[model samples]
Target: MRFYLQACLLTTLLGLYLCISEDSTNQDEKLPTIGVSVLIRNKAHSLPYFFTYLVNLSYPKDRMYIWIHSDFNEDNSIEIIEAWAEEYKSQYNGMYITTNNSSGPLHSGEQHYVKWIPEHFNHVIKLRQQALDFARKQWADYLFMVDADVFLTNPDTLELLLGKKLTVVAPMLLSDGLYSNFWCGMTENYYYLRTDEYKPIREREKTGCFAVPMVHTAVLINLKRTVTDKLTYTHTNLQSYDGPVDDIIIFALSAKWNGVELYVCNDYVYGYVQVPMEENDGIQSDVEQLVNVKLEAISKGTPLFWDPFFSKFVDYPPPSKYGLDEIYMINLARRTTRRELMEQSFKELAMDVKLVEGVDGRTLDFTNLGALGVTLMPNYEDPYHKRPMKTGEIGCFLSHYYIWQEVVEKGYQRVLVLEDDIHFTPYFRIKILLLLSELEDLDWELVYIGRKIMTDDEEMVSRYTSRPGYTYWTLGYILNQSGAQKLINAKPLEKMLPVDEFLPIMFNEHPNDTWKSYFPNRDLKALSAAPLLVHPTHYTGQEGYVSDTEDSIVLDGSAFVDGRIVIDHATSRIIGRINSEL
Candidate 1:
């Protein structure tokens, strides 16, 4: 069995290791078939979320089978399952459901629930054993037992677990509080024991797959393991051992008795499980509680993106820029075409934008630059043959400088600056909103949404960052007042470089050490996103590609006709033809 463990190279590694994951991910091969077994009681409200995430798994559906056992549900859980199965049953390799009609599930706060604990455990154990037997009967390579309330946002979760090749393992799932799926230790009497290693692993201070005594909620059983056949969910299987009536506890005990070590991988965020709210918790409804849990997850830097199906219940991108204060677009006066394209794009998304008139380098001379307090620094070297700074470079620098001046003038706290030549990612508005939630409390200044990295070794400061690394681009970034003021006070005009060139220098990422000495503070706090959300709409050699700075080229020269920017029918026809090919 090829474990294929290489694909999960930790994201904390440099870009060199990233290449390994990239290469492994592109392989064309079928993954091992696995069975997903789930038990549903009175979890009607949570079923849709679980099914949505299940269907959205990156694993090949045809290679995955599902076994669902429903019983003791009072909230139309059986009806919901039938409806879903009717639509999606054929998609999986096989899907089976066993129904047990019995009394309704009792909430934790109910007076009789404590008295019925043993009965509840009996039903759970029977269902779990049935699931295990069903997987083995179908010759499944593995079985993933997940509770209805366990929310998994990561699509690659199944594959990540399979990569470990451990006997029995579970991905660490977070609850609203510090609670997780895995326990580091158990007491002599087979109860909870808070071990010294629990906190570090739970908080992810120490990462990687760690051997743990027990894991529950959502666990993966390696059916291929030789000793797995001896594992049992029924606690009575072991006569001498006396543990609680919990199915999971018994399963753990059974696995331990058979010399199967359980492990939990906390290498990254998968998703979370709902921590049931008490009656006096003031939660209005189950849906409201789910929303609260999701919001908390977002604020804590755990990415909780869901499939587009969930968007039907909630708005994807906010109607307004929820996290940003303002958005500014820098456009040259002569480059009216790019500005028009940008306006059209933003209009489609209903985004509010302010157009800042850019300084036209074509219309500038040496005296005009000096008048504007612009001068090249002593040690500035353009990698391209150490070429002299062009008037276009000066204009580009001054354009951003003026925007920084505006950021400082209005005291805008969170500002997004955009260049006219860039195109937004398909879900730019939605992704930016989600990304901003992660940065809400971070002491950030400039974060690039689009950039060209100069260094091979980039540090991901957060889930989406490459800080303290040299990158080249001024396409799109979020800026703050302090950073704006710092850039203004840096005397950039006194020693000018291209806006793209200066950002790396200010962030202390300039490859050349000489540029760093001149501006030793290097404290602008700039970083960039990985797999940048924005990209240039046009690049060199593309038909419509044009650069105002270099080559003095203009792709679209036609000005307004009948109060509308117009392109010649011939060019339009050619563009239409080109787009059709795409």
Candidate 2:
């Protein structure tokens, strides 16, 4: 009995020791090894950028294995791939290059050929299968199949996709228009079906991952699960529409039949750039230009979308260098869509912005107006004849009021306010900073970086000026603490007017006697940057973009033209004008 008890104790201690050792092993488990299979055919021009993208991925290069399959009889793709392999093969776990020595060029379908045919599409599947076989032999944990033309701009793509832990996942790669990686749905005949979720999936709020039937261009497949389940990319023998199917549809259908789920992550901007087809005119030049622009933007720490605009201003520094750390920046966005767009824009400009959830006047309680000591004026008339202030206007006014209250409470020296639809020029921040520095001693109450110079006469006072007439926009402006106090104390809520109109009243005297008068000591010393630094995105409709603000209102024939006419200081001539239809 004593020996048995001692044996039982020893067994229990061994069990506990093994459990602790297993737990520690799990904690320090190695990252999964990824095998990247790329198909290159006549893509020498895009190879440089493609390799750069691969090298910059935020994944362990030592654990990645690359396999390049080139089948083009013409072009320098083979040479480039060979050079890349020689240089980078040592960094990765393994690197392999295979070039088809076929006497004739591989049959790529015509420029406009639809990919529904089996023969034309099977070639790509064969090459992919060959690479997959290689990866399987190497015991890769994951297999990432990527087309040579897909340019990944986001460094965290691999890391993010790995976190999803899905059987198969792909990042949505977008090109010129609606073309992307995933199909929304399929028709009864197995053709691609366009569903309503198509566009919204591309533009929707950063909600979550989306489940889809098919994904291509850049797909990450969990080989560990797939191999265990006996999945193969070469399953083109599957029937779709009563005929042999393409590899993408075949794989998707196979996964579905096997109860495997596929997902596409749209939570963040993946910054994917798909190279245009060769049939497009000047394809080489366009691809080169895009590559240069993207590389430059990355180097400058700016978003890729800003490359085109930034290219226009070669002499000026990138927006990332201009810091607004001293100024409190507030952006008013009502809907999630607006907020997302505004935040993305700010990020591109490297601006640190705080979002103020805009007040929706439609849902506002009228009884609450009494708390602000304000009342809606009865039979109020708008001079522009555009329309009277709606709940939207009330909401806008309240938003400003709330911001002013916070400013007073926090005692911030100055705060920059921006509407959601505002767009900044290349040197907007620099110009605004310069204007502020120039007027530091002027005791200015308000500075308009971009505004409708509603004043009849132009007043120029050392890059700062106050006009006789009232200005009309609140799109982008800076309000000092004094201005905030004056605005809060004015209490225009007694007979509430549009925020723009009420602002002038606060600056001047209350046009009516019912409101509290907090007119400043010096007529609210104000200044406007000449040739405005910023303008509404929908100003001229040159870009054919709609304005959410104007669209919300019911307008008559009145065309509400606003914003300053930008000018070249040296030339003293109009450079750009901001015009809008009411």
Best by TM-score: 2
TM-score of each: 0.49, 0.51
Q: What is the C-alpha RMSD of each candidate to the true structure, in Å?
A: 17.1, 17.3
Write candidate 2's Cα lDDT for 1-582 as tens digits: 999999999999999999999999888678999999998876665676677678778899888989888874455667777877886788888888887757244464534322224555777778777777788888999899998766678888899999998889998765534667888898876668989887888654444789987787889989888433455566644444252446776677777767877888888656555544443444344444344334333322343442222232222224432332233333344455556656555554456667677776445554445455645544355666635445566677777788888878988777788877666654444466677677667767777776776656666766444442466767777887888887767655655667777766655623443322433332566666776776665554544454433444321122222212233457543222234421
Question: Which tens-of-lDDT digit does each residue in 1-582 have in candidate 1?
Answer: 234444445433557677888889988766789999998866666677788888878999999988898866556778777767877899999989877666555634444432445557777788899899989999999999998878888889999999888989999987645678888889998888988899988778889999888898899998987799999888767878777888878998998888999999999788788765554433224544455455444434343454454444334223355557888889998777777767655653457888999878676554344456655665454677455455577677888888898888988998989898886654455577767887775777888998876777776877766574777778899898989988887887876667887888887878777666767678888767665878877667875677777753222222212111122454432110112223
Query: What lDDT does the true structure give each of the candidates?
Result: 0.74, 0.64
TM-score of 2: 0.51
Model 1 earns a TM-score of 0.49
